[model samples]
Target: MDKALPRTIACVTAVLGLALALAGPAAATPGVPAPEASADGTLVSRTGTAVTVTAAVGLSNTISVWQAGDTIRVRDTGDTVTALGGCRPVSANEAVCPGAGSLTELVVHAGDQADDVTSFLESLGVTLVGGAGDDSLYGGGANDTLEGDEGADFLSGGGGNDTLTGSSGRDRLFGGPGNDSIEGRGGGDLINAGAGNDVVSGGNGNDQVIAGTGNDFVDGGPGQDTLDAVDEVGGNDYVRGGDESDTCRADLGDSVTECP
Candidate 1:
């Protein structure tokens, strides 16, 4: 009876070991993992034409702010964030940052009192319908379009594919890069199309046009004017000194003569 009892106990122990092995490893605790630390933080505010952006402690280095149309964009390298100042979320890493009433398009009508307007944020689009007084318009950095109608205006396209039109004033137009179009209509104007493929025209006034780099088309219409299509590498450009006696200069023997 003692030997039989020992054999029975051994068999039971072996069976228990087999069942334990069949039950697989214990399941891990069922819960979500903790999130990582955020990399950027930002705050935005505005007063009149001036807009301010402040970054959180330790996150100032990683945050960048820019303007697109009427909306400002705040970017963070870390986690996604909600909108601020009525700005819409652009992506997980970016949000539109605006101060109070943000504008997607800023238009200045004729007879308005404002003379100088500037866009602090990069990429904001602005349009000026000139009054009798002279005006100055600046497009910081982004694809911007500016029009000067009437007064002798100064328009600058900081960066991007900017389109600037000066109508009826002795204006100065500058196109920064990324393919630009500049036109001076009815007054003596100065135009510089800097880099990228550009189209520049001086209508009716004694104008000076410089096509800087890339393929360009330049026209000096009416009065005596100067057209320069010369670059370091002598770009491929089509230049026409229209109407009255004009001077046309080109590099690498690139052909530029009288208007067709």
Candidate 2:
């Protein structure tokens, strides 16, 4: 895309040094397409033989690695060099185009399994946003936002004020710290308010919640549900209802507990 990405991404790439060298050149396979960058991000043709992303140019860029047949495309606004073959590893100190372009570094990946996405962000200590898939360890950083679209998913609010939402299917949410909100649209769900003021709501099926500390609010929107609050200066904790009977627990220190 022509629009510039946040400078923080570039800083992250530089600090983490997650850049790799472009793959070596090879004869074009008949149905294979070359990796190309687009406004949305990098689009790799499914038929591509290999895809390599040089850290120097693609650090600040969010490259969407996709496949089309045997081709792979890398679309972005940042500067890039292509080899039209397969990707390979390069040393951090390796020099290339000293004057024309600067170098960017990235941490090494330890696992042998295919871990392009996870290894990339883990190198930078930046959390990867979950797409339309089953995600377990989701959410990180201050005010992190986790969205699960389709399929069963799991979201965790690592720290600070966070928001977690599940669009469909069975979901699990954990509010780790600060004020947080967890919303589940469909299917049975489990929610945990780890700390701070938190709010949790379930859409359908059976649901369970463990509200940890501070003033908390929990709502079991449908089916049978259960709620818990251990011990605290528990004051007016709101528990909204939908259909069907629900069970609620009051801690020894509850000042004002409301359930319906």
lDDT of each: 0.60, 0.47
* Residue 72's lDDT in candidate 1: 62
**What TM-score goes with each of the models?**
0.59, 0.51
Which candidate achieves the best TM-score against the true structure?
Answer: 1
- Candidate 1 ranges with C-alpha deviation above 4 Å: 1-114
Which candidate wins on lDDT?
Answer: 1
Superposed Cα RMSD, model 2:
17.5
Model 2 alpha-carbon miss at residue 142, Å: 1.3
Task: Report the C-alpha lDDT of model 2 over 128-168, residue by residue, as the tens digit.
Answer: 23344464434434454455555576777677666667656
Worst 10 residues of 1 by lDDT: 26-35
